[model samples]
Target: MRLFIQLLGRFGVRLDGEEVPSIAWKRDRAAALIKLLAVSPQHRIHREQIMEAFWPDQDVELAGANLRKAIHFARRAMGTQDLITVTREIVAFADEVQLETDMERFEAAATQALRSGDPAECEAAADLYGGILLPDDRFLEWLDAPRERLQQLYAAVLRKGRLWRRLIALDPTDEEAQRALMQAALDAGNRGEAIRQFDQLRERLHAELGVGPSKASIELYERALALSGAEPASPAERIRASLAWALVHLQSGEFDKAAELARETRAQALGGGLAREVGEAGAVLGLTAHMQGRWPELFRSEFTEWVRSRDEFVPSVFDGHLCLAEFCLCDAKGHAAIARSAQELMCVAEDADSVAGRALAGLILGEIARCAGDLEEAETHLNEAERLHAGANALSGRVLVLERLAEIALARGQKWQASRLVQRALGDATQSWLSNHLLLRLQALAVRAATTPEKVEEAILTGDRLLTPGACQPCSMGLRIASAVALTQAGEMEQVDRRLNEAERIAGMWQGGPWAAALWEARGIQRQAQSNKVRALAAFAEAAARYEDLGRPLDQSRCLERMAAVMPAAGA
Candidate 1:
């Protein structure tokens, strides 16, 4: 007979290919006994050791009796009395019974991998280490040492494999691993990644230990800066590097970091009397503000600066235009503003021949056309954006373009095509690490596109995971609305109400935006589901008006249709 025990993550036992029932192991001591035996050297231990662990307080006679009972239960659970044997003071698995365990497998693989120094072998070992051994038994004293040992082995395997990201995930405070990763980034000429690594290490150390990075780390940081042509370089090079770092932080949603870098860069540029560098840093700060929803602040300063430099063909000028265009497209009574800003963005993008800039410009133009209910124009621009993003191998940009196209397809009742697009966007989003905003947007869309009960439930759960506290405000609001709609379709009225209520609470902070419109639309759906025709119609009408005010004709029309569906019968 062959006995296979799984001691990692969760505990389980299988005889051959069939799992033993949980009922068989219902006795806690029985399961614990098996765990102790499996982890022991050669699956054997002294009877006194087992009794001492299981019943340290009991007299020797009673403890031995309890151990016998536990042994009996464990053997019965394994479906063979021959597997476990007792001889005088020793307890062991029978010599004839072959026993295999996940712990042994992981250790064997890790040992061989470490000895050979093979990446593939290391990965295999890492995969075998499911999690800390017997996580459910975390409080058990006997498990602690083994758990720590296995965890250390896992970390060593990751480091030996040069899987720096995975190693960082394993222990963010591992300075040696972080330094290796930073050096690797520098070696690969990824100055932005090197800087990001250093910043993460420094911030983590500061937050957790009330200290900063070590001197070696500080020296490497200086090397990274020197390599990126920062301070002590030519003024122009220094300013450019600072702006580049700011943009990197912005792209990764590190707004505070981006702001700090941009402010420092702006001050240095001003000191050097560098107009272009100052504008570039200011544009980055403005864009960061826009991303964080500081709309009024962005418009007050960045707006004026963009207007003054609208004729420039610099990438930062195009970024300024893109930021303004996106805001205008989302705000009420800004159709003409959006058109103008998008036009300027496109002009700068074309002049500079920047594929990414053109892709972004095309995407915003597509969003504008889509909101205006011009499906044909929207599809044309979106298709161009998708092509550009694809040609440039820009995964995040392509995912955004696909999401817009999917929305258009869903509006046109092409559920199959829309589903396909959403799935593709989700798959690509997973591979794009710095696309949290994009991921949230795609998750919300998935919730909206779900039709069947299973799909709707999955979408709701995914939305819940994505909409954590301190998430991006606009995207999280959108996800809540989408989840509300999905819950409504699932006929989960209570959950739907909760989702809408939470959305309303979030929307309360912002006076006027697309979020307000979406909340009204969701409320209409909820009221319609509850068969409150008058309230539903009222809600949909308000939603339609809000959408129209925001220049979103397509959304307005959708709300109007809902209003019609809930309007009181003519005779009544």
Candidate 2:
């Protein structure tokens, strides 16, 4: 008899590829008994040992009776009593009966792969794992140790060079995978790529966990530096670390902390005569300002300082133009400048063979395409950006790309696709070790807006969780508006005013780039909810104007359509 068993993800048994029904195992321990026997090294167990393992609480007589029932069920489930022999106090699988199992196959494949030193075999092992062993039975005391042992072995196989990428894809925050990637780059004699890898790891660590890399990771990085013939971290290195951390704050959406750190780093770098560091710090500040929608603040931004002293910074055109790109991308009215600056960065990135620079440049172009409602172009640029990010194993860039793709899918009216993408982004964020409050809150707005009516309440609750202070004000405005829309739909009219009040207050008080346009749209939603046709039309019109001023044709088109909806239909 060819008996096959599956013990990963869930446990099941098959005979010649035919499934065994639950009726055979039914609410009982038959399947578990069969699984225990199948994976045992001996494929035979003492009857008393089995009873003690499964029913330590029962008296010996009762335990013996239960064991008898278990044996009967196992035989029926397997469709062959000849395979199991219970003689006196001993029970064992027949020596002649051959058993096949995914677990043993997975382990055997992994062992063979290791013995042969083959990447393909390692990948096959990874595929065989599917998930941790017997995930449904993970909580059982007997299963925990074995499951962990197998999981560790599976992870080890996946950590082999090139295969580390698969390990990271499985768990973005996996320190072992992160360390291996950096080591791989250094071993390849690509100092720059190695440094980029460290930067990526640090950013992900700080953003996701509100902490820095572990001591072991720092040690690994020091090794990379030594291998690349770089001197111990100089003053320039200090400034680089500072700027890198600032970016962690920025990309994770902690606008205030990021801005503060960037400003300090820029000043420190300038004082120390580290022009490269100064430019890096300035660029970090610019991206921060861009995300916060503080347009006037952006113009008076550190990029201006970098621009003025561009001559002092060697080959300043690339850094200078990149800084310019960051500034232009921050401003709602600087759409033309975003294009001009992004193009400049793209040229520099390509000329220099800088993966990060290329990814960022492509991201800028993708965002611009999104603003234009050219989903096709946006997809093209974003895909290119993702490729660059993947090549470097840059987790932060990849997550941002995924979120942008989700937004594009939302714009295309593919709700299911959009939701899945957003969920994927959220999943990546979690696994990336990100202190993800802001990203989660910001994404909650998109999810809230796109969710089904049945799920509206859950999304609103998610929005309410963001009511605490210190959220990125610009993004917060959108979250507030989305919550209000959900509340209005659910007929929670009293809470709508509070939500709208907060959104309107942010729009009036903060210079949050296109967040202001979003606020206008939210006002229209609020007025419509109040059943005030005239006011809603006016609000939509105002929103349309703001979007037009912001150079966002897509948003402008959406606002204009809303205005049209309320106008002719309701006493135009």
Among these predictions, the greatest TM-score belongs to 1
- Model 2, 1-572: lDDT tens per residue? 67777887777878877898867776346777786787666677888888877776568999899888898878877778887888767787776766888888888888887777788878877788867676544324556567877877787788752587777665556777788878787778876676777777765553444245666666676666566365566666566566656665776778899879977987777678875566556556656665665533454333233333432432221342242332245445666676777787677666666666677678878988888778899899999998877675545456667777877776777778867766666654555432244365435535454666657766665555544344545445556776676666665454566567777786786553676667668778877876788888888888888888877788899988988788776874
**Model 1 spans > 4 angstroms off:** 1-198, 201-284, 287-332, 351-354, 431-433, 569-572
How does each model score on TM-score? 0.53, 0.47
Q: Can you tell me which runs of candidate 2 are displaced by over 4 Å? A: 1-331, 431-434
Clashing pairs in 1: none
lDDT of 1 at 429: 74
Model 1, residue 162: what's the lDDT? 87
Among all candidates shown, the one with the greatest lDDT: 1
Candidate 1 per-residue C-alpha lDDT over 115-155 given as tens digits, one digit per residue, 9 for 90 to 100: 99999999989999876688655435677688889988999
Instruction: Supply the global lDDT for candidate 2.
Output: 0.67
Root-mean-square deviation of every model: 12.9, 16.0
TM-score for candidate 2, residues paired by index: 0.47
